[model samples]
Target: MKYLVMVQGSQADYDALGGKASAHSPAWSEKELRAMSSFMEELNNDLAESGEMVDGNGLAAPAATRLVGLGEDGRPVITDGPYGETKELLAGYWVLDCESLERVTEIAERVLRAPAPEGSPVYPVVIRPIPDAGGGDV
Candidate 1:
């Protein structure tokens, strides 16, 4: 089965980088940033070796995002992100082809160990099955 594991962030986290395009900037101290980067690299490599990883990437900040949807009369509507009243922004995601939901959840728990600023609260990781093209959930 294929599952998507998502990491959430806050608007302030993006703002700390000054702009959405500066998403890769070191928002934490050098030590912390390096540790987090190393952890992610190791994790990705392990997943690859295990033949579980499909694709993964850190996304640009929410400020650089655009929301597109159908408006009344089926017209296209567009809006910028940093969406009002949103408590968390999607920071990154990993798509994994794993054996079970429990296994994916375990991987997400490991992701929770990713570094964060001291005193920061534990962020939620969303784990959901990716639906298949035949109109069935994978």
Candidate 2:
């Protein structure tokens, strides 16, 4: 089965855990950023070895997001960025091929416990299975 592991954090929480300013005014430290990248590489390597890694990447912050919606006239309206009221937003994601939901959960736990950039709080990680698109079997 395929699964998408989403990394999430609140804007306030993210700002509170500052490092180097990204496109945003504040960001994580270089050392911490390197650590995160290294951790991700290691995790990807492990998943590859296990034949479970499909693809993955670290994403840009949500402040740089763009939203598209329909205007009252039914024409497309492009917004500057996210407008959700929820505190938490998706930061990144990993696609995995796992044997079972239990296995996916295990991977999620490992990701959450992975080291963070110095001075930053651990962000929340969620694991969700990707539903089959109803195509014919591979």
Per-candidate RMSD, Å:
4.2, 4.4
lDDT of 2 by residue, 1-138 (tens): 899999876555455445434343346666765786788889989999999999887666667778889999999999775456755688778899999999989989889876664445566678877878895234
Model 2 ranges with Cα > 4 A deviation: 10-27, 82-86, 117-119, 135-138
Q: Which portions of model 1 show Cα errors greater than 4 Å?
A: 17-27, 71-74, 134-138
Q: Pick by lDDT: which candidate is best?
A: 1
Measured with C-alpha atoms, the lDDT of residue 59 in candidate 2 is 66
The digit string of per-residue lDDT tens for model 1 on 12-123 reads 7666434323233334666766787899999999999999999999999787889999999899999998786887878999999999999999999999998765655468
The worst-scoring run of ten residues by lDDT in candidate 2 lies at 16-25
Which residue pairs in model 1 clash with each other?
A: none
